[model samples]
Target: MPERFPGCITRVRGISAGHFTDTRRPTGCSVVIARPGAVGGVDVRGAAPGTRETDLLAPANTVSVVHAVLLSGGSAWGLDAAGGVMRWLHGQGLGLDAGSPETPARVPIVPAAVLFDLHVGADPARQPPVCPDAAAGYAACQASLERGALAEGNVGAGAGATVGKMFGMGCAMKGGIGAASVTLDGVTVGALVAVNALGDVRDAQGRLLAGARTADGAALRDTARALLAGEPPAALLAGRNTTIGVIATDAALDKAGACRLATAGHDGLARAINPVHTCADGDTLFALATGQAPAPGPGLNVLAALAAEAVARACVNAVRAAASVQAGALWLPACAQELPVAP
Candidate 1:
């Protein structure tokens, strides 16, 4: 059996996670709530990302902390979910002081990123496109406070996620959410990712975990090999795919350190997913430091390295935990359904 960490982002102090899955369609949103606030930073690698409040996460920005981070599956429209998170935080009186004596108020800072799952499991005849809204975000925030541990696969933002789309949806496989954590020198670093890439996911040994399928959908096509063999890239829907996630730590890191950590998190994606950061994919990562551990002297680099490993493990866990989805004429298979482990 492969090595398993069995750890999640919620293990980090001051962090909580939750999900709100819509039953009408396979679409939903996920929330990572940081009580009080945490120093935040972000890195966007994909060319076609849809995000909100990312500019404020820059190291030079005046606002140094964020209240929460949201990941949703409604494409650009999913960003609205962040507003609901903000509302919830405001109700709890958790945010930056932005008002005076007469109108004292706290403004919650919630940065968000989105993935494209709009084309999956929708009935155009029955209703309009099923996308997550502010209500979904509010519900997710409530779930975070109620559910202590994070749940993975086929839930939240990853509910309708798919991967290995180099040949389009017909040959793609189901993707979902995953989480992992690692402890180093008394500090805990964790990651939670939604795997909705435009390429195949691989194991540490470069073995295909889940990806594009054969024409008959009986086996993996080794998407990288096919493209290297002169297969023309399919005309996939523009900006219709992405992999977004958050990395949380209890280490005492400043805004600049947090930004660097976010960049390092992308290394895990490159290691586990082939052909990442493409024009059609929107890959974004956010980092939060709750400052519960001792300030790093030279151990920051090592901490970042652990974050990368956790991210890679989380990527594998995403697909491995996913269950296949079949909606009338549409069928998206999961790693377990199509590639079972040997008993």
Candidate 2:
């Protein structure tokens, strides 16, 4: 039997995850495959987001389900990776039926989101910036089928991710991908987040986990505190930062309920990251329901609460699992590397 990934999204029935990491550059894509199809809903809270096929996820849309979701690096350019996922699903003969004559075959429904990690391996003077593409997406799908456990941290979409950029890359710390799940009765809700935010990350108890550092680069400089103190950001890049992820559940839910779950996920983001959902951050979350378990007695309310907890834990895990990175002149440290050891 394949090894199980404890607390990962794959713990939910009908869900599987795979990733493709670029060797030449710190960039890649992550694929969440639900080949059997599942109800999908999305909520984009970030002012500037890079996404594809999100409109169909709205409650009013006609599409009933989604086969997969893509989270990738390379900003808007990464959206192309979804095409590769479509090709893989098509090869497997898995997709929604297209009733039209021009396209009679099954068409896979893939919704995607991208975060900015274009600077990790960028050498503009020597070569063009490398980004995730269709091939990367296809490779990710293949890996998903072969791997039983999902790898977290500096891999896949979050390969080049970073956090606490208020003071710029000089003080920013490495961020990556993390997954977690919450089970109540028979229902399971899981979250997978790629942390690349423009703000500081904190735990549920409000303790600073990672964020910008002082000029001396010794300790964390709370972004919210600095902002409230009327200190201006030393470096601000608009539309260059985002935190993207997906929430999955085994409970039954319609499009509207899924959307509500997606919204509830943002509460998790807020709980873990300070100064989120800003003009510069594109925080987007997608929710999927496999409908394998009965709906909770308290309806989506209970499920939403569980989702929030999972998301928060996933976000925290992302930073904690990340390892320090040295890409060119940028030497971003991971939270684990910077945090002081308990005495």
lDDT of 2 by residue, 23-109 (tens): 988889999988498999999999999999999999999997999999999998899999999999999888999868875878999
Residue 216, model 1, lDDT: 78
Give me candidate 2's TM-score against the actual structure.
0.94
Give stretches of model 2 more than 4 Å off: 1-6, 100-103, 126-128, 294-298, 340-343
lDDT of 1 at 241: 90
* Residue 70's lDDT in candidate 2: 99
Cα lDDT listed for each candidate: 0.89, 0.88
* Residue-level lDDT for 140 in candidate 2: 96
lDDT of 2: 0.88
What TM-score would each prediction reach against the true structure? 0.95, 0.94
Residue 126 error for model 1, in Å?
6.0
